[model samples]
Target: MNKRLFLSVFFLCGLILSSNAQEALFGGQNITSPEVHEDGSVTFRLFAPEADVVQVTGDFLPSVKIETQMGPMDGPGKADLTKDDKGVWSFKSEPLPSELYGYSFIIDGFKTTDPNNPFLIRDVASVTNIFIVGNGQADLYRTQDVPHGTVTRRWYDSPGLGMDRRITIYTPPGYETSKDDYPVLYLLHGAGGDEEAWISLGRTAQILDNLIAEKKVKPMIVVMPNGNVIQDAAPGEGNKGYYKPQFMVPKTMDGTYEGAFEDIIKFVESNYQVKANKENRAIAGLSMGGYHSLHISRYYPNTFDYVGLFSAAIMAREDATGKVYSDFDQTLKTQMDNGYKLYWIAIGKTDFLYDANKEYRSKLDSMGMEYNYVESEGGHIWRNWRVYLTQFTPMLFQ
Candidate 1:
């Protein structure tokens, strides 16, 4: 054959082979897992052909009793998935409520997220696929067609802690354009959570956006500080580099965090256009964050006019060593005497800390300290915290 003809034939054969390779690699493999139907029923699918047994676990299913060091609590339920002839395993759940749910697939004793689902969130070390059933409380968590806010990850100097820590701040809509000073809500996260927890798992930005748009709550600045004193920020976001997150970290409830809370306050007041006075300032948190909020609010005594504790760890540990943990009764009494606009506490009935909260409330009652108490229906979970945020913010700075 001629040289020109041979080269042309060789190029054409290469093109044909490349086309076949592309077809074999990615042809006809479009999957839609966790399809939410109109009736709120969800169908989860996993294309695991080599799996002998597959099960789907999520909060949407019936819960099972789980025993932990704290107590017996309800845990996510699991259901077996049926394998089809095409080697795809799937399970259709009953009509779920209009809320957010997390799920993972258990294939032959191995747990994995839904590969086809793009939406997922990491809570500490464990990550799971997430989805929302719209038209209810979750709608507030969803980004709606309304004026949006700006979320920024900023660093601040914590003088007491001797390090520059990171915080997640959410400036409300029209913040950039308006010259008005906004109220600030110091929203905190639970243990094992850092600056990113409220923004990612709690959906703080979305909730604020929807609530402010509907005029349900005041347009305020949300400052979410890293509750973990051991780390400067969330995993991989700080100079600590990537490390496995744990549910309990050192110095979490030891009052050093509460003592250094002023650093965060100083940074926000100096940087953002916020109302720095006590009346416009609010502090709230969930779990360990709630514990920090309670201590910090009392320790400062006159800094925050509004305080909220959602599923908060109300007990002060005997081993907790710090000035923040010292003189709890005196500081709390001083705070009560200082006269705050709102002191709100919310907890789920099944939460391990429910009795603690109740005992704390009884203490407040004996001391004649007025606080708004809200009891919810679930255990120690994010759903109740989100609900508490929705209910608590509206009562602030009114």
Candidate 2:
């Protein structure tokens, strides 16, 4: 054989041997990091023999009060894991309630996701591994054998903001196939969230799919628009490209987003086969988005017949300007007088905005306005927001 051909053969054999050795070493054992048992107990494992310490933190554990710039609030709990002789660290949680939960592993002081769990979700900039304990409400968050909805990300012109923006829309299972006109629900996200927040973190599509399948909720279109006025879309989804997301962005709570709310409505109404009437329209949101929902619903007066505010930021901002924020009491009074099918308000008992919501309720009481109010146990968290969405949707267009 030629010298060049012999050398090439030798190199190829060496490469194959190296690849096989690496695979054998790394893929020798299958690690199931999170194994959900039959009784709702969760066992988490990590194979990190070199780490000095390993811990787990998640919403499934009890909450602890943590001090933040916004004040003290309840945050996720943490627990230590035991390392076995095989260098695998593991911890089993007590039987938890039916809910979708997220967690991260702290290996030697560095926080990271479970490599074995491919299911993950991004909340603002922090990405965490997620799992669900089924059989109840969490079942709605899961994709079952029931008919599912279509989630589409589309772009529309926002002449008020002078740019094209992105939005996430969920149409019911038979929307495309049927010639029927459905009612519309304008679902908005909280601060630090974007158009993708509801579909991913809030589990909007899954909830609608399960509920509509069960005949609990009416078949309607859900429109999720970016609440932040500064960005045209979610982080890494715009012209600027791949920037880290933060909890607070510019123009989030300002009147600009509320003033331009009509743009989103127009896009949805003109493009989709929707019932374009007050009785068939609804608007609801969480946190900052709730603030927008409150303002926008009242600002338009006769637009939406159903309004919901989930853990809303009800405090007045001295910096806010424009017609949307102006004459707040009168606009709200106008909204109340115009009437609605359902004016619902929901908040967690420990939510930081609880006091603000209470004050707003007092004002409404003084004005002789009536609304359905519900208070659950928790803080300003996504778990409560997801619950609120499920409860609010069933009450719309009924």
Candidate 3:
């Protein structure tokens, strides 16, 4: 054989051998990192025998308070893993509540994700593996055998901000064929979040799908808009580099988001067939978005009949110079007189904003306004937000 042909054949054989060795070392395609049992228990496995120690961290376990841009945030604590004779680290968790939890593996002081689990979610600056413990409310977050809706990442011109903005929209399952005009829910996200936060980390689509299929919630259109007024879209979109999320800064910008709210309303009404009226319109948000919802509903009293604040960052509105707005009380009074269908507020007992929400409720009481209040057990986390959404959406358009 020619020398050149022999050399080429030798290289090809070496490549094949290398591929086979890698497959054998990593256990090939038969690896299952997280094995969920029928009784709600979970077994997590990682093939990291070389590591000195391994542990699992997730929302299902206790969390340690860590300071963030928004405020003190809760992060999962570590659960140690046991290594077997085959160099595989494994841990089985006790039966947990029915909910969606985000978890990660810590190997030798390095935080890492489960290579065997394909499901993951991006939260703020970190990406963590997610798993759902079903059989109750969590089943709502899971994809079921029902008709599913479509989630689209759409962009619209924002002349006020002088840029184009991206939004995540969810149209109900029958939006295409049905001639009926559906109601609209303008759902907002918290700090360190963008438009995709709800649909991605909050599981908005799955919850809506299950609720609509079960005939529990009205088939409506859900719109999630970016709350940041400084930048148009989320980080890494529209050729923009990753922007570190800033808190309590957008409100100081020249243009107020509330003033630009009309643009979103116009875009949605013109683009989608929606019942654009007070009775059919609703606005709800979590954290900073909750603050926006409160101010927006107050500024435009006749726009939304239903308003919800989930662990809202509620306090007196202040100007650039740190003075409270003069017309705050009157504006809220006027909004209450406008007669809303349902003004709802929800918060976890251990939420960092619990005191703020309590103060806001006291103000509501003094103003003689009626609203619905829901209190649950937990802190400021996605688990509570998802629960709040599941409960709040059903009370709309009723």
Tens-place lDDT digits, model 2, residues 351-393: 9999999999999999999999999999999999999999999
C-alpha local distance difference test of each model = 0.91, 0.92, 0.86
Arrange candidates, best TM-score first: 2, 1, 3
Root-mean-square deviation (CA) per prediction = 2.6, 2.8, 3.2
Clashing pairs in 3: none
Better of 2 and 3 by lDDT: 2
lDDT tens digits by residue: candidate 1, 350-392: 8989888999999999999999989989898888888899999
- What lDDT tens digits, residue by residue, belong to model 3 across residues 1-398? 89999999999999999999988766564567788788888999988769999999998887788886557867687799999998888899999889898899999999988888878988766889999899988999999999999899999888866888898999999898889999999999987788879999989999999999999999999999988777678877745787654444456322277768888998999999999899999999998888878878887878999999999987544443322233668978988998999999999988889999999999999989999999998888889999999999999999
TM-score against native, each model: 0.94, 0.94, 0.91
For model 2, the superposed segments whose C-alpha errors exceed 4 Å read: 1-29
Candidate 2: 10-residue stretch with minimal lDDT: 22-31
Model 1 regions lying over 4 Å from their true place: 1-28
Clashing pairs in 2: none
Best candidate according to lDDT:
2
